[model samples]
Target: MLGEMHDVLHEFPDLKDKINELHDNDAEFAKLMDTHDQLDDKIRGLEEHEQPVSDFHMEDLKKQRALLKDQIYDILRGLS
Candidate 1:
């Protein structure tokens, strides 16, 4: 979990420091944490499936990813 989280933070360096700071530190973290956790789990599940998925399914995942990213951004903005 920590390794994957590190890779995610490294991939998006802008959020790297902020995420480190939020590693169980903030009181307002619960709501944002839920969205983050759910998205991460869904992404992992989709990626780990043995069979290949259709383009349509890929598109759906992308949309969900975008929504999750937006939610994360909104939470960060609110904190700021």
Candidate 2:
């Protein structure tokens, strides 16, 4: 199992209420957050266990996750 958790709620505990509001009310935000969490899970699983994916693919996944995080952060930061 992965040793670390990088979920949105974990990353921004202070913005718990805001995150919940957006997650429940904003369809786009919810979709992006869902995607981010899925990517996190995939990346962590790949890291802990061997997989057939190439180094490049793994890096690409990480990059995608980072972008999603930035987008989510921007939204949260604007309100907070």
Candidate 3:
């Protein structure tokens, strides 16, 4: 999944640039970044669990996913 994420950014360097461009001042981007960090931490925490039932982590992931979708939509809108 991380590889896929990297591929998306690599495949669309312009979009990545757009994101980086907005990182400094955009509240959405800041929130997205924070969500991404939380998702990463939660995922890492769950990784070592033998039988993890991570409903709360799943919710965090869902929120991050929605934020990502919004960010992508905003980027596409910018392109248009």
Candidate 4:
């Protein structure tokens, strides 16, 4: 789990083109991506020891990351 990749592009490789399209043209989508990226970086930093975080806090961060991923997936699905 520590080394797992959660970047939207990697998580949804099949939707790469659509993801890029929306990220470029949709302000909301772009914002979501920015938030997701920030969360991901935070999680990674915690896991990799770049940042210190309690286990409970890390779990909460993982949950938030998953929720954002689901929201992004829903948008991608709607585009299909």
Candidate 5:
């Protein structure tokens, strides 16, 4: 869906509390979250036609988002 929120909590509902805790205390985790958010926004913009980008560029963006999501999941797993 276009314009859907893609925040960390939304991506990992089960780790809501841990995500909040890390966001408050872990600098690296916070930075990763920010990067993930920016990537998500850019991808959404392209998807919704708000930003013009080549198909290749859009695919690259999606790949980056997937990598970030995996990294985030790893962090969350480590926190468990």
Candidate 6:
């Protein structure tokens, strides 16, 4: 489970419609999601491939991903 995918849609299945609508119409939301996905990819790659990186760096990336998820959730909540 080290490299598990944390896809936004998967994370918030109930908000799928809202997420897609925002992704299509809101550039900022799309960008944030894109960055989150990129971070997830990086983290997954590091863990899956056993890439060498400091623990602090890995923790920092995870923190950033969590922050992005929270921001996305806040946006979804406002709309939902």
Query: For this target, which candidate reaches the highest TM-score against the unseen true structure?
Result: 6
- Between prediction 1 and prediction 5, the one with superior TM-score is 5
Off by over 4 Å in 4: none
lDDT of 6 by residue, 1-80 (tens): 89899979878998999999999999999999899988999999999999999999999999999999999999899942
Candidate 6 collision pairs: none
Candidate 2 local lDDT, residue 40: 92
Model 2: which ten-residue window has the lowest total lDDT?
Answer: 1-10
Worst-scoring 10-residue span by lDDT in model 1: 1-10
TM-score for each candidate, following the candidate numbering: 0.52, 0.86, 0.48, 0.89, 0.85, 0.93
Report the Cα lDDT for residue 14, model 5.
88
Summarize candidate 1's per-residue lDDT along 1-80 as a digit string, tens digits: 31143123443578767766765687555455556566666656666653477879856865775665665666656744
* TM-score of candidate 4 relative to the true fold: 0.89
Q: Which ten residues in a row have the lowest lDDT in candidate 6?
A: 71-80
Q: CA lDDT of each candidate?
A: 0.58, 0.88, 0.56, 0.85, 0.83, 0.92
What is the RMSD, in Å, between candidate 6 and the native fold over all Cα? Answer: 1.6
- The alpha-carbon lDDT assigned to residue 58 of candidate 5 equals 77
- The predicted structure with the larger lDDT, 3 or 4, is 4
**lDDT string, candidate 2, 1-80, tens digits:** 35377888988899999999999999999999999999998988887776678989988988998999999999988843
Which pairs of residues collide in model 5?
none
Task: State the lDDT at 42 in candidate 1.
Answer: 64
Instruction: Compute the lDDT for candidate 6.
Output: 0.92
- Candidate 1 lDDT at 30 equals 45
Tens-digit lDDT track of model 5 for 1-80? 77677867789998989988988999988888889989998777777776777889878877987888888889889942
Which is better, 2 or 5, measured by lDDT?
2
* Candidate 3 to truth, TM: 0.48
Ranking by TM-score: 6, 4, 2, 5, 1, 3
